[model samples]
Target: MPTTRDYEYLLECANVIGVDYNEAENRVKVFVSQKMPPETLADEDDVKKRVQETDADVTVDVVDAGYDDERAGYEPLSTLEVIPEALEGRGERHRPVPAGVSEINAISTAGTGGPYPARVTADATDEASGAVWSDAVGADDLVRLSNNHVYARSNEADLGEPILQPSPQDGGESDDEVGALVGYVPIDDGVRVDVAARSVDRDRESDRYLELEDEWPTGVRRDGYEELREETVTKTGRTTGVTSATVEATSASVNVDFGEGGTITLRDQLITGYMSEPGDSGSAVFLEDGELVGLLFAGSTEQTICNRIANVEADLGVEILTEEPDDGNGDGGGDREPPVYTTTFERALEVDLEGASLDLESVTFGGRPQPGATVPLRIAVVASEPGSYWVDVDGDRERFEIGGESSDDLGHTVTASAAVPEDAAGTLSVSIAGGRLE
Candidate 1:
């Protein structure tokens, strides 16, 4: 759990090495040019001393000049000499400046102002001929040096606009349109109604088909020219946005089978236009008004399948009723739980000091504590002679006198106060513990 400052520092380090973060993969990748090795204190100490003697004036020249278009032709150079007039009276020896030598201060102020930059060369004239005389710049090394100073400054300027506030939950009108489908019932219409019609009669035998006795007529012929009826319904799925479509042209109940061996069937009337995608298989689908409708089980290439709320309730031995209905309000959106702390408790202890005839002054227990969380501690002691005893836990301490009336069969009772430590992330333990005499 890094803070904003920590993230800022990390970003700075990345910029120094020319890298950017990938949010989707949660990774940092090299995004720009290779980073130059940081100039080290030990390596530049002599050069820095020389520059200081010259009143901060210094000049560098590329002994073997070469063109580098990407870096604006600023060839890698070596510090030839420091001609400081201020050190003319000092014992420092003088060295002649080279002819046609380029002034280091004229290049980049960043290179000349601070500590003298490290010189690197790759030509045959450089020491270790045929080898590139370069300094090492590890990923972490570049990040540590560049993040706080360079990358952070650039990022702050680039992101100039203030952060946009999150939209308020109560700002918009509630949409009552069926949000998601849960289940559906079949209507045995000798003539299946087209999807374009707004409404259809359920009681007309020739127009509607019923699957259960509750929806059937009191007296009807069991055999004749029979027609099958089916209904497609949908519900809101957790992962998939919504599920509404059904598998038509099949005599069996609409059941969707995922290629992964999972199946889901609609046991009641399903809402229309519901769809699902991968990863939404186990999502709980709710009705448009936010009622628990069904649990999405599977989906096909063109349809989704969910277990009906009523059927699920019967199977699980529970009631299927709307306990809380959505009021077209948006306040209830978002995940329900907060982030969990994963840090471990490094140490724990319990102490018992009873029937010990000794000078007992005070005691203390110490450990790293979690912020805003309490730590429990208990202390007990006994002594033959009545005296004053003190106890300390964390940094807080208290004293208690135990004599005659104050002494019980259990001896002296000393309780340690609970506390949360300030340095909650680092190792902390009791450094010392002892008791003093009355």
Candidate 2:
């Protein structure tokens, strides 16, 4: 029964350092690095001893690389034609089947032959990458949407150029013409409205509903702009196929690297768990029940970025044909606006200031604290400047300040104990705030 504190502690220990919380398993997964020779990797016995240090039930998973090596910054190879905007080559992946290798007859995933919503190929200048299809535009304008980089060759493509499904890289040959470039929205501030790749063959019917993540809402419920905050999301792309995540930020401003030393600052964007890989761009993100939410354009090892679907439709002048479009005359049927939010710690969560620091990692009680049962509590802190520290559980607070140079060190981290005051019971609200931001 390890607590979150014990989980953090395991990450700092050797042999069991490369791990992440498995919320489903309720345990930490220890990844044995294979970067070292197999014989040199941490053995089960050694890892178990380290796991015992924190009294955590840890699962050791041996992998070919260490955590640091696994998350290395992605940088695509040189040569401007091949690299895409804001994308990089992946380290290596273990997919069910080699992605882009097996093309099913249907456009469900890694497939070609027809315009399908799940996975399709696109081409320009004799080069290709996977393009996620967006909806249509105008009366009969069946437009499929994708990045200007993937479909338009980074904005250098001519109007009506052939865009292949299951891009040539995945075996789409010159004869595999599915659609021609019809529309493109400009990318500004790392966000773009609508961009199109339309079907050249009117008989080559494509599905209006998404071909992947059928378990989620099977159709677009409504324009999801108002539902952006903390929304649960899922997506299907060519490379990574289908994956799920929670939206971390509805509005964010940040810079994105587009390879070849080109980087641009994007604002008013959505951020989510790093559920995407390199070639997942153009994957359509949706709410369960299948309402379009965002378009997957950029991502990394730790986070993914998307454009709002409403923005996509607006910019492209296209209309998404969801099973349930919002009623134009009213605010739909059922709606409840959550309270406006306040920043809990805006400037406080900064990573490594130029000068001093105070990073509160964890605070945990020995066990479930009972009313009138005071127990030993542990506090884990990483600091550049030492000072008095405080912990709060359900509004009950306590402090532990190390005086003098007694606990001073640059790598200064001390495991200190506090007390869970009597009367602390039930589910508790816990928080810790201290240290100045540089």
What does each candidate score in C-alpha RMSD? Answer: 35.9, 30.0
**How many angstroms is residue 301 displaced in model 1 relative to the true structure, after the best TM-score fit?**
3.6
**TM-score of each candidate structure, all chains considered together:** 0.20, 0.43
Worst 10 residues of 1 by lDDT: 109-118
lDDT of 1 by residue, 103-146 (tens): 11111111000000011112312332322111331111100000
List, in order, the clash count of every candidate structure: 33, 20
lDDT of 2 at 198: 50
- List the candidate 1 regions with Cα displacement exceeding 4 Å: 1-252, 257-266, 269-274, 319-438
Residue 246 miss distance in model 2 (angstroms):
1.1
The most accurate candidate by lDDT is: 2
lDDT score of residue 23 within candidate 1 = 29
